[model samples]
Target: MYFTDRGIEELTARRGDESVTLEWVSDQLRTFVDLHPEFETPVERLASWLARLDDDELDDE
Candidate 1:
């Protein structure tokens, strides 16, 4: 498994039962980037990919 999987697993284990809105997630990402500026590029890519999750073009990646 990828190293990131550990964090993903932790998140799932901690909040799997909770329901969250896209707005809430966006706000959280923004807050995270504010506190961790070095992650700006990766966070931007994640937000963009999330915004286009339903698009077929990104499937090529």
Candidate 2:
């Protein structure tokens, strides 16, 4: 598994039962970026990916 999979697994194991909204997730991402400026680019990319998860254009890239 990829190194990032551990964090994904941990997130799933910890909050698997929780139901969250996109707004909530977006807010959390923003807060995380505020606290971790070094992760700004990755967070922005993640947020964009999440926001366009269903977009066909993303598949072409």
Candidate 3:
């Protein structure tokens, strides 16, 4: 999911209050997959990383 700036802002707003919806998570994961086409590791690793909230979790962050 290639998020437009609006999409990203919407997601950030939803996540900020710790009220994350499944849709937001799904969108973010899809965005990651779209951004990193050369990912060699398992998708599970990616999923695991996506499930986390740590500051150092995502490379783009």
Clashing pairs in 1: none
| Highest-TM-score candidate | 1
Candidate 1 residue lDDT tens string, 1-61: 9999999999999999999999999999999999999999999999998899999997888
Native-to-model Cα distance after best TM-score fit, residue 6 in candidate 2, in Å:
0.7
Model 3 poorest ten-residue lDDT run: 37-46
Give me the runs in candidate 1 sitting further than 4 Å from their true place: none
| lDDT minimum window of 10 residues, candidate 2 | 44-53
User: What RMSD does each model have against the real structure?
Assistant: 0.9, 1.1, 8.1
* Candidate 3: residue 57 lDDT (0-100): 44
Give the whole-model CA lDDT for all candidates, comma-separated: 0.97, 0.92, 0.69
By TM-score rank, best first, the candidates go 1, 2, 3
Candidate 2 residue lDDT tens string, 14-39: 99999999889988998998999999
Best of the two (2, 3) by lDDT = 2
Backbone clashes for every candidate come to 0, 0, 1
> lDDT at 41 for candidate 3?
57
The Cα error of candidate 2 at residue 11, in Å, is: 0.5
- TM-score computed on alpha carbons, candidate 1: 0.92
Q: What does candidate 3's lDDT look like per residue over 1-61, in tens digits?
A: 5657787789688866787677877787677777885663555575777577575646566
